[model samples]
Target: FFFIMNLQQITREKHTYMLQTGDLRQELKKQEGYVEEQRESLFSRLVELEQSAADYCEQIGNFHTNCLQTVSSMKQNRESATENATKYQQTVEDLEKWLSS
Candidate 1:
C-alpha cells in the first residue's frame, strides 16, 4: 500500500511539472512574438530615415548647383557692365575734345 501511494504521488508531481512547463512555453512564445514586432517596426523606421536623408542630400546638391549658376551669371553681368562703362567714358572724352576745339 505504501508503494502504491508513492507511485501515485510521483505521477501527480510529473503532471504538475508538465503543466508548469507548458505555461512557460506559452510565455516564451508570446515574448518572441513581441520582439519580432519591435524589430520590424524599428527596421521600417530605419528605412524611412534613410530615405529622408537621401532626399535631403539631393536637395542640397540641387541648391549647390543653383548657387554656382547664379554666381557665374553675376560674374558675367559685372564684366559686361565694366566694359560698357569704359566705352561710355571714352565717348565722353571724345565729345569734350571736340567741344574744346
Candidate 2:
C-alpha cells in the first residue's frame, strides 16, 4: 500500500510538471510571435525611410543642376554685354576722330 501511495504521488508531481512545461511552451511561442511582428514592422519602416532619403537626394541633385545652368547662362550674358560695350566704345572713338578732322 505504501508503495502504491508513493507511486501515485510521483505520478501527480510529474503531471503537474508537464502542465507547467506546456504553459511555458505556449508563453514562449507568443513571445516569439511578438518578436517577429516587431521585427517586420521595423524592417518596413527602414525601407520607407530609405526611400524617402533617396527622393530627397534626387530633389537636391535637380536643384543643384538648375543652379549650375543658371550660372552658365549668366556667364554667357556677361560675355555678350562686354563685347557690345567694346564695340560701342570703338564706334564713339571713330566718331570723335572724324568730327575733329
Candidate 3:
C-alpha cells in the first residue's frame, strides 16, 4: 500500500510540474511578442528621424546657396559703384583743367 501511495504522489508532482512549465512558456511567448512590437516601433521612429534630418540638411544647403548668391550680387554692386565714382572724379578733373586754360 505504501508503494502505491508513493507512485500516486510522484505522478501528481509530475503533472503539477508540467502545468507550471506550460504556464511559463506562455508567459515567455507574450514577453517576446511585446519585445518585437517595441522593436518595430523604435525602427519606425528611427526612419522618421532620419528623413527629418535629411530634410533639414537640404534646407540648409539651399540657404547656403542663396547666401552665396546674395554676397556675389553685393560685391558686383560695390564694384560698379567704385567704377562710377572714378569716372565722376576724372570728369571733374578734366573740367577743371579746361576752365583753368
Candidate 4:
C-alpha cells in the first residue's frame, strides 16, 4: 500500500511539472514575438531617419550651389561697374582739357 501511494505521488508531481513547463513555453513564445515586432519597428524608423538625412543633405548641396552662382554673378556686375566708372572719368578729363585749351 505504501509503494502504491508513493507511485501516485510521483505521477501527480510529474503532471504538475509538465503543466508548468507548458505555460512557461507559451510565455516564452509570446515574448519572442514581441521582441521581433519591436525590432522591425526600430528598423523601419531607422530607414525613415536615413531617408530624411539624405534629403536634408541634398537640399544643403542645392543651396550651396545657388549661393556660389549668386556670388559669381555679383562679382561680374562689380567688374562691369568699375569699368564703366573708369570710362566716364576719362571722358570728363578729356572735356576739361579741351575747354581749358
Candidate 5:
C-alpha cells in the first residue's frame, strides 16, 4: 500500500550533510569543545558511580559483622541456659535424697 511505496521513495533520496570549506575551521573548533565537555561529564559520572559502589560495599560489610555478632550472642545465651538447667536438676536430686533419709 502507501506505506510500502513511501518506504521505497524515502530510500531513493541521498542523505547529505555539507560542511563548507570556509566553515571547516569553525566546525572543528566546535567539535573539539563538544568532545571536551563530553569527557568532563563522563569523568564526573564515573567518579559518582565509584563512590556509590564504595558506600554500598561499606554498608554490606557492616551488616555482615552485625549478623555474626548476633549469632555468637545467641550461642552464648543457649550455653548459659543449658548450664543453669543442669545445676537446678542436681539441687533438686540432693533435696529429695535428704528428705528420704
Candidate 6:
C-alpha cells in the first residue's frame, strides 16, 4: 500500500509539472507575438524615416544646383559689365585726344 501511494504521488507530481510547462509555453508564445509586433512597427518607422531623408537629400541637391546656376549668371553679368566699362573708357580717351589736337 505504501508503494502504491508512492507511485500515485509521483504521478501527481508529473501531472503538475506538465501543467506548469504548458502554462509557461503559452506565456512565451504571447511574449514572442508582442515582440514581433514591436519589431514590425519599428521597421515601418525606419522605412518612413529613410524616405523622408531621401526627399530632403533630393531637395538639397536641387537647391545646390540652383545656387550654382545663379552664381554663374552673376559672374557672366559682371564680365559683361567690365567689358562695357573698358570700351567706354577707350572712347572717352580718344575723344580727349581729338579735342587736344
Instruction: Quote each prediction's TM-score.
Output: 0.78, 0.72, 0.77, 0.78, 0.64, 0.74
What's model 6's overall lDDT? 1.00
Pick by TM-score: 2 or 3, better one = 3
Per-model lDDT: 0.99, 1.00, 0.99, 0.99, 0.88, 1.00
lDDT of 5 by residue, 1-101 (tens): 99988877766542222335437778889999999999999999999999999999999999999999999999999999999999999999999999999
Model 3 poorest ten-residue lDDT run: 13-22
Residue lDDT tens for model 4, 8-99: 99999999999999999999999999999999999999999999999999999999999999999999999999999999999999999999
Backbone clash pairs for candidate 1 read none
Candidate 6: tens digits of C-alpha lDDT, residues 23-90: 99999999999999999999999999999999999999999999999999999999999999999999
Candidate 4, pairs of clashing residues: none
Candidate 1, residue 42: lDDT: 100
Per-residue lDDT of candidate 2, residues 2-81 (tens digit): 99999999999999999999999999999999999999999999999999999999999999999999999999999999
Is candidate 1 or 3 superior in TM-score?
Answer: 1
Better of 1 and 6 by TM-score: 1
Tell me how far the alpha carbon of residue 77 in candidate 5 is from the true structure, in angstroms, after superposition. 0.9
TM-score of 1: 0.78
